[model samples]
Target: MKILVTGANGFIGSNFCKFLVSQQIFPRVFIRKNCDMSLFKQLVPEWKQLEYVYGDLRDKSSIRPAVRGVEYIFHIAGTIKGSSWIEFYEGNCLGTLNLIKICEEENPDIKRLVFTSSMVAGGPGTPESPQCEDTPSKPLENDWYGISKYYTECCSKKQTNKLPIVIIRPPMVIGPGDKISFDLFNIAKIGIKVFVSGTPRQFSMVHVEDLVKGIFLCGTHPKAIGETFNFAYDGTISYRDLHEVIATKLFHRKYGNLIPIPIPPPLFYFVGLILELVSKISHEPPFLNRPKAIQASASGQTMSNQKAKQILGWKPKFSKISALEHAGRWYQQQKWL
Candidate 1:
């Protein structure tokens, strides 16, 4: 099958590319002109048939050729961090809209467009109830990334009749090439864990391996067309539980137990302010900014993969703990630890 994969160098997309190659499907990967080739080269498996189309999604001229002859399109390119709402809207919302418009003009009969969306778009969840596909989306206030993604999802759904599209929302994805997980795992390696002072927040997570499988199902499964599915480990776990899992279950090192450091929301914002200031000088957004600080202090964010399991008959092969172990090994192998 002719397939086109966007964001092929990113954490989840890189894993999807590898999965495609393993299945003997060589997809044409769409990359930006200024994308980091080093990380892309290291993460994406090489194959003689593997091809690349260098272009930016916002530029219609560049994206047309990438979608012209492809049977399936994996629209995974998006910005998780942005300096403002417009920046997020341009990359996450407008970019998808542009691709949709171009695809309608170029390849009207395309098989499917599988979009990798974030559970953040569906808003934070509580441990009492994990977020489901049917959940009414309520993205955090001032969270540009989440708001933009939510709008994108809404826009994509509107074009369902013209383009076969499937939306897959992933919660706290963990695997190789993930920067946030590296930070979390790396800090855990030092026998310390951070927690905000409040009710322990819950989380839903998926290994990149299983997330790619869900994405594949969304692309090819008949029932997945014109639908949105959240792919994650079955249920939610508290951050406390997650912290223990990483340090005890994965590390199994001396240090006895990880020292828990509880910080207030105000302190998190203080740190975020400092990082934001640093970002001004560096021109690179810090992982923890004001909006991120809001997210960090927010309630548990969880999701349910039941729809994918039932409709696509897809079952996750890795639990959160097992996934962390796998990610840990990969980090060591990549010398990213």
Candidate 2:
């Protein structure tokens, strides 16, 4: 059972690859040339268990060898942030289409091609009313990342007949070895928590471990073929409650007083604009960009886990707070905190 994991150096992808190694299956990992492997290396000590294949998803020649003869292709690589809409499109949509064509032409007999879609792809929902797989995608115009992923899903679905494709849309994924949440932990260490909105923001999320297990099921399950499911946990968490959880549950010790500061939208966006200016020059996405700020200030952004639970018989082992506790401990274990 040959398997190829694209974006294997990423948080979820790397963790899934590690899980595969535990099952005594050394999956082939497709990585970018000269990409950072520090996190992936740190997670997997017996790194030799993975067959590393360096290439770009956009490069056909580079990916042909990686796509050839693999039974399962975990298409987890996609742009999370970018300087512009085109950058997101190239990274998410074009690259995915490229992989799909290569799979069709080079290895049509592949058992499954599992895509990691974002929950935002089918959004315009709140915590009180979450989006399910049956709901139509209503990606916001300001969010290029979400739109790109939706476009990729649209493109991939067209080729489902040609290639076995299973799309799993994951909510805000939080867990061990996540590089994105480093800033939150760092801020927590400084004994401060800030928010732009007075009303707490509720969100749906899943631990990486649970999400990876779901992805595995998607790759192997016959029912999941040509289907889409949301791989989110069965509940929601707010930023304020999350801070409390981090302080009390993350350390499991007497943590320092975390000062909660609430600022107006104007002030927050002012700071975000400054960061965006700096990011423009750095070619890195600003942490508090327009779309991100919208998400931060919104009331709720949630996805339903009913489809995953009913179809895959999958439920998250760790609750929202417990998941954060586990992730925070790992960050400390690796000195990321």
lDDT of 2 at 324: 85
Best by TM-score: 1
Model 2 lDDT at residue 130: 88
lDDT of 2 by residue, 1-337 (tens): 7999999888888799888877878889999989878778877777876788898988988989998878999999988866579988999999999999988889989999999998878865577788889888888767777889999999999998888899999887877777666666666666677677677778888899999999999998879999999987777877666666687776553543678877676677577667668877886445566556656665568888898988888877888878888888888888877
Which ranges of candidate 2 are over 4 A from the true structure? 251-257, 265-270, 276-287
Q: By summed lDDT, which 10 consecutive residues of candidate 1 come out lowest?
A: 39-48
- How does model 1 score by TM-score? 0.94
Q: Give a tens-digit lDDT track for model 1, residues 1-337.
A: 9999988887777888889988889999898988766555665547446888998888888998899899999999988776678888888998899999999999999999998888989988876777888879998987788888999999999999999999989888888888756767877888887767787877888999998998998999988999999888876776556667778766785443778888898998788778778878986546577766776788878777778889999899998778988988888887876
Candidate 1 — which residues are off by over 4 angstroms?
A: 253-256, 276-287
